[model samples]
Target: MTRIAACQLAPVPDGLAANAELTADAVREALAQGADVVILPQLVTTGGVLEDAEQARAVAVASGHGVFAAWAAACTARQGSVVVGGFCEAGDDGQLYNSAAVVDATGLRAVYRCAHLWDRERVVFAAGSAPPPVVDTAHGRIGVLVNYDLRFPEWTRTAALAGADLLAVPVAWPAAQPGEGGGPDGQLVAAATARLERVAVACADRSGPGWTAGSCIVSASGQLLAAAGPGRSAAWADVDPEASRDKLVAGSSDLWLDRRPELYDRLTAPRSTSG
Candidate 1:
């Protein structure tokens, strides 16, 4: 069983130093609770709000250096727990990306650039064109999805099809508007996705003034295992990676074996509009 920790942080807007410190504190706190892996909210290292794309690009850092070095050190000290979190990444092509990384005692294991951009994000960040690789870790085969990626069924399904037992999501989810469901959109989607994909999912979301703070850990069967309510908190859960591999829905209804992929060619075809 893999014990996972999801951290809900309320970052100080535009305060990088304070955010890093807060992140470290959360990591330590999660570790103290016996977490095998810790996941933090999107852009927790440098806070989510930025003046413009220029500011975001300027603050982006390379993996395994600076802020990442500190996070890696924290994981190394724990000697086992893998830490996954989001940040402003300086890509190899000199562009900026909203990215997430997985770190363990061995060092940086995987990095994922958010493929789906949300609202203002498209103006400040470049969307990733490819799916992130599934990482083989001590706990399980881990995959990463960013904030808006959760809205795309194909994204998570792709990860699960690639044998990812766990999906770690780092998000800065906004609260439901005045007349909405009074619950964050992330909550329902996370649960639904986990149920459909049969993969254990952990989402770490930022909590603050206008955010919903809907961080949660879901079992392979889509059960809400743990949740961090409306404040800065940590949610923990124990999951068996192998359990997700079972594609059985009932007596003889298997998820994977019953696939009819041959008829799914249209899924990849571009749509045409009527003139």
Candidate 2:
């Protein structure tokens, strides 16, 4: 069983130094709790919802930023431990991207940029063209996805197909308004995604004004193992990543073997105006 911790934190806007320490501390704390994998909220190094592209560019850091080195140092406390967190990335191509990095004792392992932008994010970030990366780690094959990317089934399916045992999601979900049904709760969406792909999922959400503090860990069977309560906290759970390899859901119902990919051509086709 691999222990996972989803840390929900309130990052200080534009305070790189402060948020760096905040995330590094969270990693150490989660590691102390025997967590093999620690997941942090989106834009953890820089609070979410930037004003414009210029402001985002000002705060964005390359994947090689020292903040990740801090996280790597924290992971060194526990051998083979892993950390996944989001940040504003200053891409080598001179564009800003909302990206996440996977780090372990060895240092930064992989980086995944958010592909599906949300609302104002489109104006601040350039959507990534590459699919979510599945990193091979000592704990397991970990996949990553930023906020808004979770809403696309095809994207998550692509990760599962790439042999990701667990999906670590970093999000800053917007809070629902009074008298408004907040579509589907982020936690519920995480659970549903796990159930659909037969993969475990850990979502670390941010807290603050206009955000939902929803952090949770779900099993491959879609069980809500642990969830953080009100305010800043961490949700802990022990999941069997190996169990996800077994695609057999029931007697003869094999999740992967029953796929109908040939009929999914329209999934990538342009949307039709008239049904």
Candidate 3:
């Protein structure tokens, strides 16, 4: 079992220095608590600045530079732990993506771009066309599904089918979006976890009235393990990847049941001209 921690923070807008410092503080806190893996919210650097694309791109860092690399070194020095956090990337083509990086001893492990950009994100960031959940870590196979990926069941299912024992989500879930107010994230999270019984960590920004939307971690059996609200707070969960796989094979552990794929496909099928 690996001890994991999620940092849910209210990041200051465009304050790169302070943001990095605050984020580092949370990482240290998680390490102090014996976390072998720590996950942080999406867009930790510049907040949710969808209006200013250039500014967003300016803050974007390459895989091996800046805060992401620093965190990786810290984790490696501590105990060869893994760290994940959302960020923007200035690609070689000069386009930027809403990305999340998996950090470890050697530096960045895998960088995932947000495939499903929500609302105004399309303007500030280019949509990532790749599917998620790359299983390339020392601890075990872990998948990354950034914010807005939560709205689609197929994304999570795709990861589960691809052999992800654990799924980590970095979100900026707003307090008032849809049924999100008053623990809606928990219910949605439980339902999603129940679909593919893998330990999931959804680290969200403590945003409301403009940014950050708290965070939560759910067990494989649709149970809300821990959650945090607005402020620089974090939560810890012990995840057993082998046990996660074992739970799926146990049948009654609530992994991959009641998934009505045929029904969805039929509904999505285009109407025939015969009508």
> Model 3, 1-117: lDDT tens per residue?
777787777677777777777777777778877887788888887665557687787677776667876786577556668888887777777788888888876777888899999
State TM-scores per candidate: 0.93, 0.95, 0.83
lDDT of each: 0.84, 0.90, 0.71
What global local distance difference test value does model 2 have? 0.90
Kindly indicate the candidate among 1 and 3 with the higher lDDT: 1
- The TM-score-based order of candidates, best leading, equals 2, 1, 3
Model 2's TM-score against the true structure: 0.95
RMSD of each: 2.0, 2.0, 3.8
lDDT (tens digit, per residue) of candidate 1 on 32-56: 7788889999988778676678888
Whichever of 1 and 3 has more TM-score, that candidate is: 1
RMSD of 2: 2.0
lDDT leaderboard ranking: 2, 1, 3
Which predicted model would earn the best TM-score? 2
RMSD of 3: 3.8
